[model samples]
Target: MNNHSMTRRLLIGLMTSITLIWLIATVMGLSVMEEEYDETFDSSLQETAERLVPLVVDDLFRKEEIVAPQQLQAARPDEEGEYLTYQVRDKTGKVLIHSHDAPPTPFPAPLQGGFWSDDTHRYYTATGVSNTIFVQVADAFANRREALSETGLALFLPIFALLPLGLALSWVITRRALAPVDDLGLEIEAKDSGNMELLKTDALPLELLPIAGSVNVLLQRLRNALEAEREFTANSAHELRTPIAGALAQTQLLINELGQGPGKRRAGQIETSLVKLNHLAEKLLQLSRAQAGVGVSEKPVDLIPVLRVLIDEFHHSGQDEDRLICRCAPNARLHGHYNADAFAIALRNLIENALIHGDPDAPVEVSLKADGSISVVNGGPVYTPDELAKLTGRFQRGHTTATGSGLGLSIATRFLEQMHATLTLASPASGRDDGFEAVVRFPHQD
Candidate 1:
C-alpha cells in the first residue's frame, strides 16, 4: 500500500528466500557427504574382513600350531586397511582362538554365513575352516561414529565460512537495488509547494517504472488541482473587488447628497461595511501575492539604518500619543533579496499593531542588535500558544476587538518568509506577564 510497507515486504521476502536456499543447500551437501563417508567406511570394513579370512581360517584348522598373537597383530595391513578383531569357534560356540583386545560383549548370534548388526559393535562375517570350526571377523561401532563426525565437520566448515560472505553480499545487493528509491526520496524532498512538478521515471528499472510513472501522474494531478484552486480564488477576488468598490462609491455619493440625519447614519453604516470589505479584499490580494512568491530582490542592505528609518517614520505617523523607543547598533547589514518598500510595510504593520494593542502611555520598544536580529516588544495582553500560532493566519484578530484590520501580522509574516527570514513570537519570561515580544532574524551579509 505504502512505500514503507512495500519495501519491508520486499526485504523480508528476499531474506527468507535466501535463508531457505542456503539451508537446503547446506543440508543437501551434508547429506551427500555423510552418505559418501558411510559407503567408504563400509567398503573398507568389508575389504578388511576378506583379507583376514585366510589367516583366521588357517589358524582355526591348525589347532595345535603355536602362533604368536602379538606377531600377527603387529603385521601392517596392505591395500585394505583394517581395524578389526577375529574369533575362531567350534560348532558348540566354544572359543578356540581369539584376537587380543576384543570387547567383552558377546558377538551377535551366528547367521547363515555373514550378517552385520549396526546396533551392536560388530560386523560378523563367518567362514567355515572345516565342518566343525568357523571363523568370524568383527569391527567396532566407535570407528563409524568417529568417521561420520569428521565427515560432518568437513561438510559444515565451508557453510560456516560462507554465511558472513552471504550476509555481506546481501547488504551490497540491497543497497544497490534500493538506490532508485533513495533517489526518488531525495527528488521529492527537493520539491516544495511552489514547485510541485511531475517527477521523471526514465531512470527507473523496468520493474519499478510503473510505480514511478503513477507517482508522477499523481503529482501532476495535484499540481493541476492546486493551480486551479488558486486561479479561482484570485479571479473571484478580482471580480468582487470592482463591484464592492462601485457600491462603496455610490454610498459615498449618497452620503454627500443627503445632509446629516437617519439617512447619514445609515450611509455611515454602509461606509463601515465597505471599509471592512476593502480590508478583506486587500488581505486577499496580499495573501495571493505571498503565495505567488512575489516581492523579493536580492541585494546587500544595511538593517540598522532600515530599523532606525522605520522607527522614525512610525513615531511621526499619527502616533504621538504613544512613546516609541528605538535602539539599534551601528552598521548591521544582511545579505538577501531586500525590497525596501516591502520591509518598510512589514515593519510599520508590526509597530502599528504593537502601538494599538499595547499600553498607550508605556513605551513600544523596538531593538535591533549587531547580529542582524531585531525585536519589537510591547506591553499588552500576551496571546496563548494556540492564539500565537494562528496570529500569522489571514484575517486573524488578537484577543481584543480592535478597529484595525487583522491582516497586519499575516502580511509581515509572509513578507519575512519571502525574504528568507524567520519570525518568532514569545511571551515575557515571567510566564504570565502581560507583554509579547516579536523577534525577526536576518542572515548576516557576506
Candidate 2:
C-alpha cells in the first residue's frame, strides 16, 4: 500500500552522493593541508634555531665571566608576545642565555640537532662552537593546531552553501528528466473500455517506445474482442425475437384450441417459457449496449419527457395508476451531458424491479429531488447490507419468488457508470421500517 515517487528517490540519491563526495573531498583536503602546515612550521623552527646559534655563541664568548646565565631582552620589549621561544644552553645542561619569553629552566630536548616534541611544544636544537653552545627554538602545539583548524573551516564552509544549491538544481533536473515517464503513466491510466485508442509513440523517448508499442497491441486485441462480443450478442437477440414471438403465438393458439384439459395446461407452460426466454434475450441485448458505453453524449438533454413516457407505458401495461406514485420537485433538474435513451433504460429497470418485487398491496413511490437525483422507494422486506451488495450482479435475484431475468440492476449500473453517475441501493427506505430504496445520483448538473 505504500507508494514512492521515482523523482523524489532520484533526487535524494543524487544529493546524498554529492554531499558524501564533498565531505570526503573536504576531509582529504584537510589532511593534506595539515601535513603542509607542519612541514612549513618545522622548517621555519629549524631555520630560526640554526641562524641564532652563531649569534648566541658570539655574545657569550665576549662576556667577561660567563658564570651567571643571562636573559636576552627583545628589541621591542613592550610588544605583545612571541610565538617562538628559544634558550641557549651550555654543555652541562645549563641555560646560559634565554630569550625574553623562554622559560628559565633548560628545555627537555637532548643537546643534539634536528627536532623533538613533547605534549606542549615542538623543539628544534642547533649547536655551534663544537656543539658546546646549543640553540633550541620551541613552537607551541596550540599555534599549529589553530592554523589547521582555520584551514579545515575554510574547506568545510563551502559545502554547506553548495549543498542546498546542489539539491535544488538536482530536483529541477530530475523532474525534467522524468517528465516523459509521468506523461506516459497518465496516458496509460486514462485507458478504459470506452476509450481504447492506440498510444502515441512518435514523441516518446526511445526507452519508452517499446512500452507504448506493447500497450497499443494490447488495446487493439481488446478492441477486437469487445467488437466481436457486441456483434454476437446483438445479432443473437435480434435473430431470436421473431421466432420466440411466433412460438408464443402458436402456443397461445394451441391453449385456446384445447379447452380446459391437460394439453391446454401444458401449452400454457410452453407460452410462459417462451416469454421468459424472450425477456432474457432482450436483457442480453441491453447489457451488450451498456457495455459498449452508449450512455455518453456531447450535449445535455431534457429527460423529463422520457420519464413520463416510461411511466405512462408501465401504466398502460396493466399496472394500476394509483399504485405508482410519481412526484417531481419544481427545482429538480438534470442538465448533465448524457444519452436520454440510456437514462430511460436505467430508470425503467429501477421502476420495474420495484413494482415486481414489492408487496402487491403497498404502492411504489418515485420522486425527483431538487438536486437532480432520482429515488424509487417501494415497500418490501428489509435486506442486509451484504445481500443488497450482490443485487447489482448479473443474474442475481433477491429473496423473493418474483419472475425476473435478474439483470435489471446490473444493466442499469453499467449504463449509469458510462454516464458518470452512481446507483445506490438501501433497504429500510429513508423514512420506513421495512422497504427498499434505489437512488440515482449524477455527478454534475447544468
Candidate 3:
C-alpha cells in the first residue's frame, strides 16, 4: 500500500543488519589474515636467509672472489620467485655478494638488527659475528598486496553470491507470515448487520486467535444492542404517535367548541403544544430510520417537483410566502439516484430551517444551480466560521427560544449522506451583510 508497510520495513531492517554483519566480519577477518600471512611467509624468508649465511661465510674464509651460490640465484629468469631479493654488505654499507634480482647498492635504509619496511620492500636484516657483515632479505610491496587481495576475494565471494537469495527469501517469508491478517480482514469486511457470525479462528496462528475472539464478541454485543433499540424505537414511536394525534384532534375540536373566554385561550395553547410534540415525535422517528439505514431506494428520483411542493406549504403556514424564492436554470432537469422519500425529507427540512431562522422581511432564496447543486439562502444572524462548521450537529439550534426541534439540519445532513451528497453551511451568503446559506452539492456526474 505504501513504502512504509511493516513487511517492507522488516525486510529493509533485516538486510541492513546482515550487510553490517558481513562488513564487520570481513574487516576483522582481513586484519587477522594479514597478520597470520605476514608471520608465516616472513618465517620462510628468514629460513632462506639463515641457510645462505653459512655458505657466504665459508666463501669469505676461503679468500675467494664473490660468486653467486647455486641456491641463491633465481630458479628461472622470469617467474614469481624473483619478488624475493637478498644482499650482503660490509659495515660501511658497501654491497658485496647479492641475489640476481638484488640492487647493486645497499637497501634504502641503513641496516637495522631485525625486520623493517620502507615504501617498496619489507626487509629482514641479520648482523654477522664481528658486526662487519650485514645480510638483508626483502620482499616486494606489490607481491604482498596481490596475495592479500586474493585471500579477501576468496573469503567474501560467498556472501556476495548469497545476497539476492536472502532478499527474495525474506520477501516470501514475510508475506506468508502476514497472510493470516489478510484473511481476517477479508472475513470481517464481508460481515454486515444481517451477517454477524463469529469469525473462524481455527486455522489462524496463535497470535491472531485472541484478536479474532475479541472482535467476534464485540460484533455480537453490537448486534444484540441494535436489535433491542430497533424493536423499542419502532414500538414506542407508534404507541406515542396514536395518542398524540388523538389528543391534538380532540384539542382542535375543543378549541372550536369553547369559543371566546379563558377556557378557549387555554385550549388553543394546549393544541399548539400537542402539535409541537407530534412534530418532535415524527422527527425522532425519521432520525432513527435514517441512522439505521432503512428506506434506501435503488430507483432514480426527480428533485425539483418535491422542492416545489415544500415551498407551497410555506404559504399554508400563514407566513409571508413571497419571501421564499425558487430559481432553476431554464432547460435543465435535475435527477439523482436516490430514494424520492429521502430527497423530500432533506429538502423539506432545509426549507423549514430557512423560514424559521431567517429575517421575516428579507427574501429566502432557494435556487438550483447549473452545476446540479441546490442552495437555500435566508436572512439570518451573522455567524462566525466556527459556528457554521457545527450547524449540522444534532439538537444544535441557532437560538434556544426558536420553536424548533433543532434536528432539521442534522436529519437533512444524514439523508444527504445516504445519497452521496453533502450539506455545507456558510454565513453571509455571497455579497450579503448578514444571512446564512445551506448548500447541498450533488455528486459529480450523477
Candidate 4:
C-alpha cells in the first residue's frame, strides 16, 4: 500500500485500541465505585438496624400491646437520616413497629445477615431478637447510582476530549517520521536520464538507508553501461572510417590507372562497395545520435515547400522522373523545426530503399499532409506483421531483397527518432495491389 494508506490504517488501529481501552477502564471504574458506594450504604444500614434492634426488642416482643404511633414516628427520623427504612416483626411475621414510609410488602424477606434486591436498587439487613422480635433495615440505591454515574462521566469525559488531540498528534508524528521518504521522492523527481547518479544516503532512516543505497548502486551501473555503449560506438566508427576512406581513395586511383574493359568493371564493383560502406557509416552515426536523444527546438515549417524541394532533388539526381510522384495536400504546413540535413537523409534513404526493392515499373509515391505526418508508398510484396516489426531494426532486410543494404530502414528509423518523431511500416490500407507504406509522424508545436 501507499504511505498515506498505510498511515491511515495505523492511525485507525491505534485510535480503536485507545477507544476500547478507555471504554473498558470507564466501565470498570464505574463498576468499582458503584460497588464501594453500595457497600458503604449497606454497612450504614446494617449498623443502624443492629443498634435499633436492642432498643426495639421489648416493643417488638410485646404482642399484647401495639407500639404507640408517636414512638414509631420518633424512630422514623433515624431511618430517614440514614436513608434507610425499618420494620419490626413478631415470630408470626406481623409488623409491630415500622417506619412511617415502610412499604406494604415488608421489604422483601431479608437474610439472617443481609441481602440485596434483585435489581440492586436496595440493600436489606435483619437481626432476630430471641427468635420473637425481628428488625429489618433497607437502604435505597439512589446515592450509589448517582456516584457511579459521576464516576463514569469522570472517566469518559477526558477520553472524548483527547480523541481529536490524539488524531492530530498521530498525523504530526507520522509526517515527521516519514519526512525522509518525502525528501527522497523530491530528489527522485529532480532526476532525469541525463543525471543518473547515486542518491545521497545521509538523512535516511537506518532501516531505509540500505534501500536508498541499492537504488544508487543500480543507477551507477546503468550510467556505466550507457557510457560503455557510447564509447564503443564512437571507437568503432572512428576505426572503420579510416579504412573505408582509404579503400575509396585507392579504388578511385585504380579507376584512373585502368581505362575501360575488365579493369573498369572491377573499379565499378569497388565503387559500389564504397557506396555501401559510406551508407553503413552514415547509418552508424545516425544510430548513435538517436541513442543520445538528439532533438531540435520546434518552430513552424512549411511542408509543401519541403516536399517540392525533395522531389526536385530526386529528379535532378537522375532517379527515374516518371517513376517518382509527389501528392502534396494544398497549403500543407507543419509546426516543428527539423534538422534539414537529417530530414533529407531520412527521406532519401526511404525513397532509395523503395526504388531498389520495389517493382521497377511501379511508381514510388510520397505524400505530405497538414497533420504533421508524411508517408512513402512503394509497390512491392507486403511484409507480414513479424517482418514489419523487424523492418526498422539494425541490418534487417526483407527476405526478397538480398542485394540491398539492410541499413536503409534502420537509418530512417534512427533519424526519425532523433527528430523526436515516430516511424511505422505497414502494408497499404488499399490492399496488396498498393504494396507497403512507411509512415513518419513528427511531434509538432502550436
Candidate 5:
C-alpha cells in the first residue's frame, strides 16, 4: 500500500532531485574552493622562497662557516608552522643551512629552479647571489589537504542541517497540491446508479480536467440510456393495460350470456386467463419501477404511521382488516432513513404473502422493533430448505395452490437490497410445523 501511493512517489522524487542537485553543487563548490586555496598557498610558497634568496646570499656567498641549524630563526618544529620546511644549497648541490625539521638533502633536482614537486611536497626554488646559492621552500601536501578538509566541513555543515527541512517542506507541498484529487476519488465512490447527476470537472486543476470531463461524459450517456429503458417499460405497460382490461371485461360479459354450457365454461377460462395477464402486466410495471427508481427522503420515516396507513388501505381495498395485526415496540419510535417508497413495497409484499397463503382463521402477525426490525409471521405452509433457497427468484412460488404473479417476494427482495436492507424467509418461525415468516432488517447508521 505504501509503495502504491502517488503522493509518496511524488515526495520521494522531489526530495531525491533536491539531494542530487545539492550533491552535484557541493562537489563543484568543493573542487573550486580546493583550486583557489591551492593557488593562494602556492603563491605564498613562492614569496617565502623569494624572501629567502637575499638572506641565503648574504650568509652563504661569504667565506663563512655554515650557520648552525638552530640559528635559522624559523618557528620551532613542534609548532603548527612546521608545515614549512626550507633547505639552502650551494652550486654543487650541497646542503648548507636548513630548518631543524628539514632533511639534509636538496629539496628538488639539483640546479632545478622555480617550482617543482616530488611524491609528497610542493617546492619552490630561488637562486641567490649570482645564482651560486639557492634557497628552496617546501610544504607537505597532506598539510594542505588537512586545511582544505576543515574548510569543506565548514561549508557542508549547513547543507546537512537544511536537508531535512527541505524534505519536510516538499512533503507538505505535495500533499496539499494533490488533496483535490483525493477528494474527487471519494466523491466518485459515493455515487450510485440512483444518482444521474454528472460529475463536475470545472473546479479541478487543469491537468486533471480532461479525465474528469471524460468520466462525466460517460456518466451522462449512462443516465440517458437508463432513462430511455425506464420510459419504454412504463409506456409498454400503460399501452397493454387498456386492451387487456377490455378483453377481460368482454370475456366476463360473454360468460354471463352463455351460461350453463361448454361455451360459458370456455369463456370463464378465457376470463381467468385475461385476469392473470392483467395481473402480470401490473406486476411487471411494479418490478420495472422498483428496479429503475430509488427514494431518498430528508426526514426519517416513522414506521408506526407508515404501517397504520398500509393497514387502513388494505382494509379499504376489501382485505380483512381483523386478519392483520401490527405491534410496535412500547414507548419507542421506529424511525428509518431508508427510501420510504421502497420500504412500503417490501412491507406490503410481506403482508400480502402472509394473508394470501396463511390459514384464513389465523391472524397474521406484524411486528416493529425499536431497533428498526420488521417481521411478518403467518400460519402458512412450512418450506423445505431447497424451496427457501429458490424462493426469491422470479415466478417462483412457495405454494402451488396460491394464485399470485410470484414476483412479489423477488421485487421486495430487490428493493430491500437497494436500501441496504435484507428479507429472509423462515419456515415455521415458532419452530412448529405450520408457519412461515418474512423478516426485514434495515441497515443501521451511527
Candidate 6:
C-alpha cells in the first residue's frame, strides 16, 4: 500500500504544526525566564551590598586598627561554597573584611558605589562612612546559567512526551472524520450495469452530499441509455427472426427446384447468405439479453451439468466427436450463483469459436479444474497481444477469414461480467507452443 494516504498526510501535517508551535512557545518562554533571572539576581546583588555596608562600617570602627584582610567565618562550617561572595575595602581599594568564601584579595570592582561585572561574576559596590568604606557583593555567572539550564530542560521534557500522544489522538480524529468519504467511494465503486441503485446519502457529511448527488445522476443516465439500447436490439432481433427463417426455408426449396443449373448455384449462394443472416440475428438476441443483465442469480447453481449439456449438443450438431475432448479434475465442483442459461450461452460461444477458428487437423480441448475454473484450448496460429485485445470487441474479426458474426466474444464477455466472473484470453495455450486459450474464472465463495 502507498504511504501517501490522506489520513497519514493529515496526521503528519497537524502534528508537525502543533510540535512547531510548542517549540516556538517554549523558546519564547525560556527567553523571558532568562531575562527575569538576570533582573532578580542583579537586585539580590545590589541589596546584599547595600545592607552589608553599614554592618561592615560598624564592625571596622570597633576594630580600633586594621592590619590585614579578615575572613569572616560562618557561624557553622560551610561545606558548599557560597553563591554570593563579598569584600569590604577602604577608599584606596585595600580589603579590610570579607565573607568566608571570598578570595583573600581586593575585589576587581572599583572602590565606588555602583554596579559592575567581570568574566566570572556580577558585582555591586556600596560606599559608606563618607566614602571611606567600600563593600562589594559578587554573584557567580555559573550559578545564574545553571538555574536557566535546569529551567529550559524542565520546559523541553513535556514536548517529547506530549507529541506522540497528540499524534495518536489526531489519527483517531482524522479517521473518524474521513470515514464517510471512504464509505461513499466504496458505494460508487460497487455500482455497475447489473446494479445501478441510487447512492444512499442520508449519513453523508454536507461536503460530500454534492458529490453523491452528481454520481447518482450519472448512474441514472447510464442506466436509461443501456436500457434503451438493449430494448431496441432485442425488439429488432425478435421481429426479424420469423421473416428471416421463412425466407431461408423458401430459398432452400427454390434451390432444390432449380437443380443442376446456374439458377441453382445462385440459389445456393442465397441460402448461404440467409443462413449467415439468421445466425447474426440469433447472436444479436443473445447479446441483447446479456446486456440486459441476465447472468446474475440469487442462489448457488451447479454449472458442471450445463457444460456437459453443451458438449453433447455440439457432438450432435455435426461437429466431429473425435475432434472435441473434455476433461474434469477428480471431485471438482463447479457451483456459483449465476444464471445457467447465461453460462451456457458464454460457454457455447467459446466452444463454437474454437471449432470454427482452430486448425482443422487439431482437436479442441475443454477442461474443468479443481478450483471450478473452465478452460477452452484449441490448436491454432498464435495471436499477438494487440490482436487478442481486439478479438473481444463487437464486429472485430482480427485477421480471421472464418465465417462468423464476431459478436460471440463480446456477448460472452458481457454476460460473464454480469455474473461477476472473469473471462481471460491468452495465446500459446498452456503447455502448447502455438494455440489460443480462454478461461472462465468464477469468484470464490466463502
Residue clash pairs of candidate 6: none
> Across residues 276-378, which tens digit of lDDT does each residue of candidate 5 receive?
8887788778778776756446677766677778878887887768888888877545566667777777788888888987777889989887777788999
Candidates sorted by lDDT, descending order? Answer: 6, 2, 3, 5, 4, 1
Which lDDT tens digits does candidate 1 get at residues 225-273?
8777677767877987999999999999999999979999999899999
For residues 339-384, write the lDDT of model 2, one tens digit per residue. Answer: 9999999998999899989987899999988888999999989999
* Per-residue lDDT of candidate 4, residues 1-446 (tens digit): 64557678878998899899889887887777777877787778778878888788765455576743322755443454535677776666666677766654555665455666756346555666556667777766675666678778878889889999999999899878877888887877765444576788876899778878888887888878877887787678777888888999889888889987997898989888887777677667665655554444466454456567888988888867778888877656655667665677788888888777887878888888767688888887867898889988877888564366587888778767767789888875245555878888887634
Tens-digit lDDT string for candidate 3 (232-284): 76677778899999999999999888869999999989998998989888888
* TM-score of every model versus the real structure: 0.78, 0.88, 0.72, 0.62, 0.74, 0.89
Residues 10-46 of candidate 6 have per-residue lDDT tens digits of: 8888988988898899899989999999999999999
- The 0-to-1 C-alpha lDDT of every candidate, in the order given, reads 0.70, 0.89, 0.80, 0.73, 0.79, 0.89
Total clashing pairs for each candidate: 2, 0, 0, 0, 0, 0
RMSD of each: 4.7, 3.1, 6.4, 7.2, 5.3, 3.0
Q: Measured by TM-score, how close is model 2 to the native structure?
A: 0.88
Better of 2 and 6 by TM-score: 6
Question: What lDDT does candidate 3 reach at residue 293?
Answer: 58
User: What ordering of candidates by TM-score runs from best to worst?
Assistant: 6, 2, 1, 5, 3, 4
For model 1 the local lDDT of residue 67 reads 44
TM-score top scorer: 6
